[model samples]
Target: MIYRKDRKVLKRVDFGAAKNSLMGVLAALVVYALVIAWGRVYEAFQLETLLVGGAVVVVTAFRLWLVARFDALYGAGPARWRKLFAFGLILHALVWGLLPAWLVWRVGTGFNFFVVILYNVGVTTALGSSWMAGLKVRQFYILLMFLPVIGALFLGGGLREWLLALLVAAYTFYLFRLYRGQYELFWHAVTRERRSGGAERRRELPASTDIQLSLVYRLAHELRTPMNSVMGMMSLLEDTRLDDEQKEYLQVAGQSGKLMITLIDDVLDYSRILTGRITLSPDYFDLRGAMEQILEAFGPMAQAKGLELAAVVDRLLPKRVRGDRDRLMQVLTNLLSNAIKFSERGEVRMDVDFTAEGEHDGVLRVRVSDQGAGMDTDTLKHLFEDQFLDGAVDAFAVRHTGFGLLVCKGLIEAMGGAIGAESVEGEGSTFWFTVRLGMQADMSESSKLSGAMADIQGVVVGAGAGSLACLQEEFEALGSQCQGARDYDHALQALRAGHREQAEFDLLLVDTHGRRELALNLCRNVLEDPSLRPVKLMLMCTIEERGEPTVQRLVDKHGLVTLVRPVHRTGLRIALGRLLGVPRSQPVQDLPTETPEERRRRKLYRLLLVEDNEVNQLVTRGMLSKLGYQVKTVNNAETALALLDQENFDLVLMDCMMPDLDGFAATRDLREREQREQRPRTPVIAITANTAEGAQARCLAAGMDDFLAKPVHLQELETVLRRWLSREDDSAAEEPDSE
Candidate 1:
């Protein structure tokens, strides 16, 4: 029994340290061959040489034993394995250093075949042992095992050996490159494991526990701040003494708050999905209605960014389908979001098509296409893989967590659908997915209509704030009733009382200023309450202070609408019109309908271009000018500041990522000067491609209004200017000094 128990334990240890043991043995054999070679050449096997050789064997054995012991004791943590491997490496060096080559050569009879074979076997075994212990060891071990064989063939005497040597050398070079690539991959995995923690017995328990707790804490805190902001803005909105402009500004604050709450919910849901805790609740619902709702949600974002967004549904499809409405909407929203994010100058097209089944049934196909920076086959293959963003070492490239596509895939697959992508590098990409659902025979007849009529009520919040007054005016002028909020408290009180008081607002909007927290809280309270479940909420804010996770949560949770700060009147009006079911009096061409040339033209704007380097200035000027923008050039912030004081440019294109009077300091000075002299605040848009960490927040905090990363695409510049310029005129004109 005792022997059996010991054997069992040894088996377990052997299973764990098998790879390392093999590597040690192989290393010992290589040293043995060298020793024999030295012995034969020198014909001397002294006591000192024997002691060194014995020490080499002893050290190798000891190191292998230590590794096995450590793994048995500590559960073979990666760190412990590394330490043991280092010791083995030391033993290898010692063995090679102390071996008596002359004695080996003499005893083994110059180039003894037996010694060579034994040494090769030993070295191969040692290397193979180490390789086998790894996660994906088989392939690597085979490669390593073949290396020595090739080396021996190359080193062997004779014409055949010489020919084999040439082949071996070529193979060796290839293997060397392969090893370098694998090492990079190994290092990447190690770093990721260190950062995200290991996946093993206790993997999810501790690391996930911490992540969950941290998320909960962060959500609670972050949600509260935005809630407070919304509440405060609503409170101020109730103050009748405030002027229309002030009221408009307060309304903007309220809108921003609502957006914050929406973002919070999105992040929470996403986190839940990440933790494998998201439960899909499927129910029969109107598929068209769901698509319309999603479009309405993202309409504001697309408009705010000056991007054209449109959804086309084939009339032959059934209006209603049985599925998880929320998950389906999420998939659509994610696809649309990606389309909008990547596209610069062109329109994002979303089309729904119906594929007929054998007789009457059919599948619903949704396709989203964008003329943005599309991916190559290589990128597309890894698009949905986890930790893909870490591989994007370039700063200027668009960053993605790879979570969106993965979630989309999961949701679609769960709903019995297939999703895929088709793309051409640099041209465009189209992501399409199909959902199988039982079609309603009777309902299919109604689908002959051009577009489904949507009954949407537009409720404009924060109409009292100066920045949003024009937006409010635009919405009202379009025949939608605009509700104004001055602060968060007033908005919450109004939201809470509106239902009871027989006064109902279909949409809530808040600005993100002092009322950011209030707006977010109001959204949470409203969304969580069953009584207030019907009302849709929207938020408008600068992403300057918030992290991606925060924004993602809000978007995932509450079906909240987000309009980035400094939205134009047209964009705001169109979004509100679309959401509230108000007909757009002006038939503006949708983005998807616009040609590339038209897009370029529409995207052009007046830019206050600032650059210190003459060559850079010239390069930028030529680029912007070619893109059809009116460029106002300045060599430094001083000149840019003077130009701002003297002229009303569409946007102040500042070089914040510059040297000397760097962008941040210059922005601070500009804001300070504007406030001190009572000058209208110009929107200083930072033109930088620098991912030099923390530059974005610093720019925003320093009072620079907006940012556009460097190697600036004309489309990006156009979008920023169109949004910021419109808001600039409203905010800038509202300043007391301006009057």
Candidate 2:
């Protein structure tokens, strides 16, 4: 057991040492690499030289990865990463000590052997002095690195070796005296920063971008650690037996946690844009899914106020388009958030359409309309400007918070998109934005519907006109003839008429616009009507509506499929197919849907999954294994380093943020190692929740070949994997071994 006081002191030591050890540690690795390459210098003892040299390289690289991320892995309560970091430092010294002694014992006191002794002295004093603080740890490291060399020299016999050993011994003693002073000064500085708050001091520094970048990564690590734990525990619990109510509670907790994590990532992205680094990351994504996601996020808030929240995509628009999904979602989120915040009743709806620009390119437009207190003309003029002028809040009739509007404006303009809004006083507002997107080759609006729901009939009862039209289009898109109704009476009449022809209607979709009582009556009528028995009864309700006792009873006893508000077409299609007792045979059209034969044909290449969380591990490995890839998952950067050194991997799927280290630095160091050893470059793809373009650039700069955003979908994963794995390696031809 460890005492808290002693642990605190050790944390300080580890933190300080980590701050100043990276460059020195990297220099030590360079020395090791150089020594390994010089193995041919001892031609007679080449194999022995290579053996010890390889050990040096491995130990140095291990130190490099650990020291690079020691602070991140160090938490307040657990000393797990702390102890591991200490062990790495000690091992680094021990390896340096024993390996060189073995080299001299094997090579004898030849000319090059003396040269080896001199090299060891220079490296020991040089690198050891560079280590910042931590008196005991550094002193121990110094002794271990020097003693073996001194002992080996004394064992060399003769007056010449003795004289040189004495001189080295005198220098090591002198070096310790000097190192103590250095440690004292560095420790004081660490204490000072710790007392004042390191971040406060960092912010006061001159380099603005560096300060922001460090803060972003540090905050991300701090938040991600606990979120990972919560989600991991949820995943573990999912495998256990539980009652129906308990399972539902667990499911809700898991989904809420996922949304929270996404919100945290948005915080990071928001900070990045504030740094004035923005770009567009265009890729293939489902537009309908993106819109549905934003609407779902704000649906509950709207429903709480007895308002309707819905999104509609034009039937003429492609299901899949090539654009920057993150920015598009960000823009939509800002608009929808404002819409729901200001709206008290009525409806908030999002609409989408396309404007063709060329054969392969087009402008995608989105509009968010809300029945909120409309902005005045004066407020609309300065809507995106800072509302607080001279510390005075005068901008009244605005839509969203000024900061959010500014961020959205910057991101949209960076993507070559335009944003504007129109409003009428005392009425409502509609904000619209447009961005250029690439059309998939031979893109078409219609998907060939399969026999699962082909030629079927459905009735849609919606509280809002926008929702009514949207649901009908979605039904028709799935090859079902749909009849729309504005109210419950019309829905019942349509059902009665359609069901007269031997249950003509295959499904019924009802949207409960906060009218729990009305929805409950409709469910009872559906159960009582014998003709509607074979028809799939589905209700789209808000969170509050789902809690109504009658609605719960109708769903539990009568086998009604209750869908949460803001349901997407894809999810609805699958649910209907399952209820109808048929496989989901819907066409994806130009969407990247992998067939069974093609999925199986993918080579079972070895994949290294470097994620700090077990839930993420559960998610990623489960997906990759199904795709036939042999996966090896590691939780920390050091273990990942060790594995990469020992085994060959075709590709690496790494969470750019790790528990103890920023994956960017780790990947950067890994790239440097590959170059030093002249090894083949394996594609390293970053798995991140922040899909902002600046973050993508940072990943690439850190030596990652590509990126996959979090909550990764199967189709997207397949596309990313196939693109990288199928490419010819341009760097596979190593340079001839010239040390």
The candidate maximizing lDDT is 2
What would the per-residue lDDT of candidate 1 be over residues 507-556, giving only the tens digit for each residue?
Answer: 77765544556666766777788887767676766544234555557778
Q: For candidate 1, give the lDDT of residue 413.
A: 70
Task: State how far residue 501 of model 2 sits from its true place (Å).
Answer: 13
Among the numbered candidates, top TM-score falls to 2
Q: Give the TM-score of candidate 1.
A: 0.32
Error of 1 at 592 (Å): 39
TM-score of each: 0.32, 0.48
Candidate 2 regions with alpha-carbon error over 4 angstroms: 1-276, 296-301, 387-402, 424-426, 445-462, 475-509, 526-539, 542-564, 571-583, 586-739
lDDT (Cα, tens digit) per residue for candidate 2, span 52-171: 667767766776776666656665333676556567767877876776666667665444444444455555555444455446766776688778877988998865455445545544
lDDT of each: 0.56, 0.69
Error of 2 at 124 (Å): 48
